[model samples]
Target: MIEALAGPQAGGVDDLTASDLLALARDRKAAEDRAAADLLVVAARWADLHPPESIHDAAAFAVPGCEHEEPIAGQGAPLVAEFCLAELGAVLGVSTTAAKKLVGHALELRHRLPRLWGQVQAGRVPAWRARSVAEVTIHTSPTLTVEAAAFVDAQVAAVAGRVGPAQLDRLVAETIKRFHLADVDPTQDPEDGYLHVDPRHATIHSDDVHYAGTMRLEAELDIADALDLDRALAHGAETLKALGSDASLGVRRSAALGDLARTQTALDLHTQGATGIRDADGLPAAREVVLHAHFDATLDGLTTVFGPTGRMEEGQRLVLLDQLRSWCGDSRTRVTIKPVIDLNADLSTPAYEVPDRIREQVILRDRTCVFPWCTRPARGCDIDHVDEYDHHADAEGRPQPGPTRTSNLAALCRFHHRLKTHTAWRYQMTEPGTFEWTSPHGHHYRRDRHGTTAVDQAEPPCPPDIPRPRRP
Candidate 1:
């Protein structure tokens, strides 16, 4: 019935008047409400998933304004365009083309100014008290709408103070209550840990069968004692496993063990029920833990927890369990690569160590990252082996692994650990404590350091007048 009334068929219903349109309005109103609801749902979903520009496009389709058909048809296209151009030129005091562009800008400010005026009449403020603040505050940036609104409120409060402070406070409170409430900031830890994790690329072969990969999560944790790390790991793993299963519904996972280098002690496999820990009431408490496990499906299921939950007991306990799951659920991790520089082709092992008694000897030398153009500190770098000890043959009968030695070792941070694999770049030992780096284009870079004294340079000659040559 409502559809018929809204459709062209309604023109034949002579008994129907504009008032009867409301009588058939029930179904029409319901349909309109559902349409609006559907629109809002789609708008929210689009905003959550898309960029702002895309959201604007979605909004244009979702909420179109009434068309001015009569004005365009009566005026004729060229005459209407000319009139619009002339009117815009007069308003902006510019050429018609420039005026056309400025039309939207004028309407935008003109539209918002009335809202400011309404707030003033409602005991908010007159234009005199607010325009200066509003101009600076609102026109400052398109992003600071809240700031602009705040400036309006502040200006009103100042003027109201001259009239009556109590009345002004009530007015401010009422405006906030009747209009919009500002979001409160969440309380968090003073030291927040931010991790940027890039997952290693893994391929699933045609059969969806694959064996793979490595530990590569980074965290900022206290190097010294404050929290029980092992327990935390267990709790974290539990949390992550739950998250992987249901991302939106589950808590963040907490474990940190898989990413850090481990010695593989039997303790790595141990699982114990919660026993000693307790809450303030002295009841049995849940413990934090992580245990390793494997799942054969896609690796995209992992969930990461990002913040500290220290004070909320129940939340902390749950978060800790999730963390444990994160650590234990992952069965594999990416391998860490290191770089080594070898001077001798046959020698093996890259460990560089001077005898303890000769400690003073090594320090008088090398100062920084040994790599060409790198300024990394030498103290934090690893002394890497340039070659492997074992020699293996390929199916075609070729020597596989080469030898290694101290002369092959070079200092590198974790970042540049695998950078030496580039085919175009090569480095050679010029002499002890010196290296010459050559680029693909034949460019050269030299890195050198000297000890307190040269080993081969002759010691200062003995006093010429005395027994300088007596021993010889």
Candidate 2:
């Protein structure tokens, strides 16, 4: 079933019909995606093909029986970049500059927006979309500070696929306007007195060479003036909403600004709601979205996403959490700790069923398929009984089930679980948050909540006489 764990004939899934594949894909995607990302990274590291070091002299570098045994260039990251550009240019038939730009875009995303890069490796975000975000964000405000630029890029990457191209551009513009304003930076020199001319947008012009509505409106208003204009427009839109108007927010706000140009209006939530133009309490609170946190994975000071979803290395997850906290606010954000599986606790009464509480604990502990090096998030995996279950009839003809307790459970994404069932490889919960696995080659592995380590001891047995399953 290594083939099922991977390969074109994976888990025999490649042979499945479209309908069957669809259902299976949902369960297998996390494992498959993580596997794919790992494989791609591995492939990139391998020198068998497309080695960047070979790019300087494509015909000579690393080639067998080549006269030039010496290297073409000194080895370092810059050389890597140069070779990448040259190689890409050759393969794609583009100039080195264009290839450099392409490589730069990829490197920027990988370096700055790790979550987005992971999604790219997971095949969730396409190349075009990632490139689009990187390019337009750069174009929108070329002078943005480093902190501002990274914040905006990461924000755009987070909400990448939820919006369209035009909307993405608009969002980029909004983010730039919010973070790249004339006074957004606080450390600017007060001695360098430069005049900031107010937005000269009393004039609106459409395509100068055509009749299209597409136009550019340049602005340089004072920060307060810009904020005031936004508020007035929002207030006007709210007032119109209170009056039962069915205009879009953009349209209503634009009209509100025009009304403000003629007659000043105010943002008064209480007044608008009293007039029945808006909800008396303003808009309803945003609904909650589940963000699985692995407290165990939260070693030191970083929190990790539960599955193959998104992640950052070292303190990056901390940065992301701070950003999310800014968005979710203090009161709305909450945390729940999933204790390590006790190997002896039963939280439910259902026969052969892992109750939600116990299942959550195992998922938090395992964080992925318990197989060695598998990074599939536990949420997308099956809760397998480390000890094989035996079903039988008890006295008086009633059904008795195998123990469905925490100590007996481990999270194994479907493929690994099936692999265990179908082959000589076997694993058992040797202790709390620990699994000892024996591979087909008799190699022993210890996978715990932390990570995998090679072991010299044989696989241990699960605690015997696990309480019989609860009565039917």
Return the top candidate by lDDT: 2
- Compared with the true structure, the alpha-carbon lDDT of candidate 1 equals 0.36
Residues 1-472 of candidate 2: C-alpha lDDT, one tens digit per residue: 3224443544475667787666666657656656644543442332223334443334433433221222111111122323223323323334434554565455445544456667767678765566666555444433444455566556766775455765665555555555545444356443322222222344544223111112344565767878987887888899989999898998788667655543233334344653433323353223344554323234354333522222322111222444433334534344454455553454544367777888877766666677765556788889988876655544446543446777778888765665565445678888877888775445677788676776764345333334212212
Off by over 4 Å in 1: 1-365, 386-402, 450-472
TM-score of 1: 0.21
Candidate 2 residue spans exceeding 4 A from truth: 1-288, 294-350, 393-402, 456-472
**Cα RMSD (Å) per model?**
32.3, 24.6
